[model samples]
Target: MVAPSPYQIVKKLKVSRVLVFRTAQRYRRLGTSDDMQRRGRPVTVTTPEAVKAVREKIRRNPARSMRKMAKEYKMSQGSIRTIVKDKLKMIPYHGSHLTTLFIDEKIFTVEANKNGQNDRIIATDYQSACEKGKILNKTSHPASVMVFAGITADGKTPLIFVDPGVKGVALGQFSLRKPIMDLPARRRPRSSRQRDSRVVSRQFSEFISAVDWPASSPDLNPMDYAVWIYLTEKVSSKNYPSIKALKTALIKKWDEIDDDHLRAVIDAYPKRLKAAIKAKGGRFENYS
Candidate 1:
């Protein structure tokens, strides 16, 4: 039988006519279809060592500029950029300035008012205390302290200080155990929202029993509406040279917060929940 024509092969094999013809010609001439080494300059800069070095630098500081990296690595800026973009698959991002209002505004309301009248829902969060002058002016390396605290309907808990640059397992080990253990079992409300980090901790589920709350309802949290705002205002009014000084001032101000004021804030939860429901999980106008 005669061999099929290239057109017939193209139709039968569902391949391009050019590819079929090329394959036939190559097989007749070279007796194999493997790719031959073509004449071109070999790659020099994108070596395995260079890739490892580039990855290490990026791991060390994600925000490091491509120009700075090129200067340090003695490679062309274009080469460094290619490594970052194509080889490393990283895109440079200017960090966003996040605010509570922005987050609360985005949260879609969930059905979370099963026991609307219960006063056991606690609220917890992290607040950064830095010199207000430096923050306002946007100048020099500003020292800050990450303060973790919570509030119940009755009153506030003692302030917890998380060390700078600590997260994940380190955060779990350094900060979570004490405050959770110290919480009076009587006041350990049936449910609470302590932000994503606290919720994700390995020990969190073990100590704090499983309780669900609407992810987007910070407006419902007394800590966000009353505690943090008040603390931030009080802390910002003074200046501190170091985090230690800032922490001392924070503890002082926290102690000064009257139980009456705290109770009032806690009592406002029902109204906030009602407002949240009225708005269908959007930002409540009454939140202050």
Candidate 2:
């Protein structure tokens, strides 16, 4: 090897010094070199006990509002979400039923309930209009009644069909139940490979049948708003044929829904309940 020239040595030293100076400047900006803890607002001020307190409140009632929850438990929504999510391990919930949700159409209201009070008189869908009549069952001659379905996540909600006269969503809602009682048709999970085994397809897995659904919580029921929409479709236009026809139609439509789909809705109950309870009775938001 040939010896390097003095000029080459000087150039190499200059490049090394420039690199060190640039790195030092970057560290100074970040406050690491000066030992300065960069000042910023704290992300979390609530303690773990506070997290647990809010979590317990949510565990008891998921239909309550965040405003109420914050007031009652003294925490913010971010804090609440973190506690409920991280500490409680609750999943963000949505409805299980994969049905064609009708949103664009507004059902005419012959009756006014506390929820859907807007009588905007907008034009309605024709097919929805007919279905609305079946469910809404307006008397037309002296109309002042509404047919609302208060469904819950736990298998169609038994509370609804029982009284159909509760006020709060939890009390007012009914669980979706199948018409017949039989051995669960779901298959079992096994620790085996596909190549070696003949798989038995059960209609429902143990999970599918054994889910304990939440009742009347909107977090789980995306269709809860849709159900409200279903009611609006019924009484709108103030032109119904008869009450008997509407009731029969509503009951019929309820029966036609698939059992497995209903179970899926129930699966979303915990998340729905949490949202409703967190919001303290505010409208159930469609987080999806």
Best by lDDT: 1
Q: What digit string (tens of lDDT, one per residue) describes model 2 on residues 1-288? A: 995554565586665655555556768688555544548875464677787677777778776676677667666777767766777788656444332211111122234332234433233775665565434433454433333333333333211233334333332222222311221222111121121111222422543221454345343344544444444454333443554554454556555555565455545555666777888757766542
Instruction: Rate residue 57 of model 2 by lDDT.
Output: 74
TM-score of each: 0.42, 0.27
Q: For each candidate, how many residue pairs have backbone atoms clashing (under 3 Å)? A: 0, 34
lDDT of each: 0.63, 0.45
RMSD values, in order shown:
22.7, 20.2
After best superposition, candidate 2 residue 277: deviation in angstroms?
3.7
Q: Write the per-residue lDDT of candidate 1 for residues 1-288, one digit (tens) a residue.
A: 998888899999999988998888888888898655568987689777899999998899888889998999898999998898889898888784221111111110111112324423333422232221222332344555566666555445577776556653554444545554465765454444344555556645545433655566545566667777777667765456666677777789888987688667766667888887888887767744
